[model samples]
Target: MRSATSKARFPILLLTLLVSISAAAGEKLTALQLFQAKRYAEAQIAYEQLAAADPGNAETHFHLGLLALRRNATDTAIAELERAVALDGKNSDYFAQLGSAYGAAAQAAGLFSKAGLARKCRVALEKAVELDPDNLDAREGLVAFYRQAPAFVGGGIEKAYAEAEEIKNRDVLAGSLLLAQLATGEKKYDAAFATLDRVLADHPDAYLALYAYGRIAAESGLRLDVGERHLRRCLELPPPARAPAHAAVQWRLGLIAEKRPDLPAARAAYAAALELDPAFSPARDALARLPKP
Candidate 1:
């Protein structure tokens, strides 16, 4: 009984509806299952299909964004996550994901010498926190993003330090560690030392803080002795932490020894690092670079 125009549109409408429903069901099941199983690539495909079928499905887009993030597709993740947030403005998780996507993009941009992209990352992260004040992950991401981003790109060391202090008052050691990293980035060597000292004063065996301190020292080029001490302490920590710490410390020590032309010590350090983490590429590379003894 429909007119010709209606008839033509009717089939298309019906087909669209059917496709949407099928895609939704398939995406809902496959995305969740695959995501939970850590099959992010497959999950991304399913989410993409659903997003294509129903562009208004914010959750599907969000999942696709997360999947892209897992695969290190920062640009794709940003586009998908931004779409997801636009479609569902009230979802805190969407904002958080969007922020993380921006942060990833910033990291990629830094590698390519695109400062603007890094600034955009900070804006996205700030918006995420504004949207979800209680989201610890979002806050942590913001702090980390800011710390890694250049000062000229809205990532001042002072700001990072203040944020860390705020987090510490709230009893978040992880955030405090990130703040210390910011201090290190700023070349506020004394400030960095004080921040880590405070943290270690309260929790001396905090392996994460110790590791961060070691990394800061190694990179800053101003505190080799202090860095070496922190790294050694990290190695003394317990269990899984000890393994990573040992690897990192040994690698750094190997570099120091290499600089000093102490080939034997460098070789020993590199070997020890590899023993702790056989897959540590940096240590392996260092070993390769060492002079034959």
Candidate 2:
């Protein structure tokens, strides 16, 4: 277990202070500006003040819940989100976040306790989808539930596949990658690749699809050559088409090279990742772990 002082802190959420917030009717924008500036500690304090001032504001609690989740304070996240849902019972997004918190907490729980948390996750996610049929994240959370939990508790690839079909009908690009990811989770590599093939065929320049393709290939140790190719292409894309987190693609490339036992390639990729964003700890750690030559 980590030390108590650090358990609820994330430096990534505390990085920049460039953008300023214009004075607005609501202080929520102020908190948002702080969050965007990566001043997470200040943002949390601001959010706490907002929540205290407006005890009935559901959105305040929701934002606090998000901040807590980013800090890995899942228990706090669940509490804040519960308040959000209690105040605004109609919000699908609130319930979805609560479910995500439950899921995160369940990862470290004992077997019996894990089951209970999983049940909470399942219930909240289902409620979110019921409240909003078009809630994509809620639907994906439910799919994750079916993929990971036991049959008695709600896990089933069959359920995930059914949800995948619904997603497919909604957004072809995202849906295809999501379906492929689900297939990957099921250990159906061939099927997953075939689905990805369709994604590439239809939208050859898609940012999400390329990242998904690279991630699956690297993580699964399948089609390494193809994975490396697409991952490199993903890294080369301009900001508009690049992944929101630019260093992520470089890390994926590093992962591919490392898994292939290509030490020099892995080191280069990791170095490139750190060059893009020195705060990217995964790349930094990977680079540090390489044997001194």
Candidate 3:
């Protein structure tokens, strides 16, 4: 019943729609690529555009929230992360990131609001862990919360230790590092060092264990020479996904150098840290505070 002109018009409209869909997909891919490359500024703009075009796209909102967090935009990150969680409640990562955003907001909040924000963070992180027990990042956040929050807020040192044990049961390397961290926080430096030493003995090539040895020394101001040696060894190994970035190892080296009163070494180490990650604010701050030669 359709006229030839009408049929031709239908084909043209279909082709246009197909092309538009393809363009949208391509844009999303490019945005993701930028994000993976750590080009946060560009990724943020791209994600903003995508979110505007597809308001229901949870992934875009999630990445946008992460970008906001990188820039210390806590309120914006919370909003975007909340939107992502609302859109997809089943995503463990969304909950984990939302919990972190809440924790950041708590830090900046007045005393009266701090308890409430902290509670929100705990609840969100707990939910994330419940959703995905294997999510070590979520567990680590919960462990941190347990370590820092008062008993009145459902947190305690015992709880933190228990959570670390759970993490250790899953991934021995991550768990050992975490346990060492907790022990160090409690001023149990000997225990921390022993734990790391055992891991290194079992897996000599474990760069994370090496980094932890350096971190403990940096924090306790003990064994600076040994720590420097271990840290340098870390640099010789290829980093794993879960290990601290090279910048962090470099920062620790800077800390050791400072403790040694070797200003030049400290400056050079901090500079190297910044070279690895220009956005590493701690290195930048350390550099700024260093006395001018």
Q: What tens-digit string does per-residue lDDT give for candidate 3 at 1-293?
A: 99999999998999999999999999999999999999888998899999999999999999999998999999999999999999999999999999999999998999998998899999999999999999999999999999999887778999999999999999999899889999999999999999998888889878988998998998899989988999999988888886788899999999999998898999999999999999999999999999998
Off by over 4 Å in 3: 218-232, 235-293
Model 1 per-residue lDDT tens digits across residues 138-183: 6676677656667778876566666666666666576677667676
Ranking under lDDT, best-scoring first? Answer: 3, 2, 1
* Model 1 misplaced regions, further than 4 Å: 1-30, 49-55, 72-75, 103-120, 144-155, 217-230, 236-245, 256-263
Per-residue lDDT, model 1, residue 86, is 86
lDDT of 2 by residue, 171-236 (tens): 787678778988887788889888888889878877788888888988899899998888778767
Specify the poorest-scoring 10-residue window by lDDT in model 2.
Answer: 16-25
Ranking by TM-score: 3, 2, 1
* Clash count list over all predictions: 0, 2, 0
The prediction achieving the highest lDDT against the true structure is 3
Error in Å for residue 6 of model 1: 30
Q: Is candidate 1 or candidate 3 better by TM-score?
A: 3
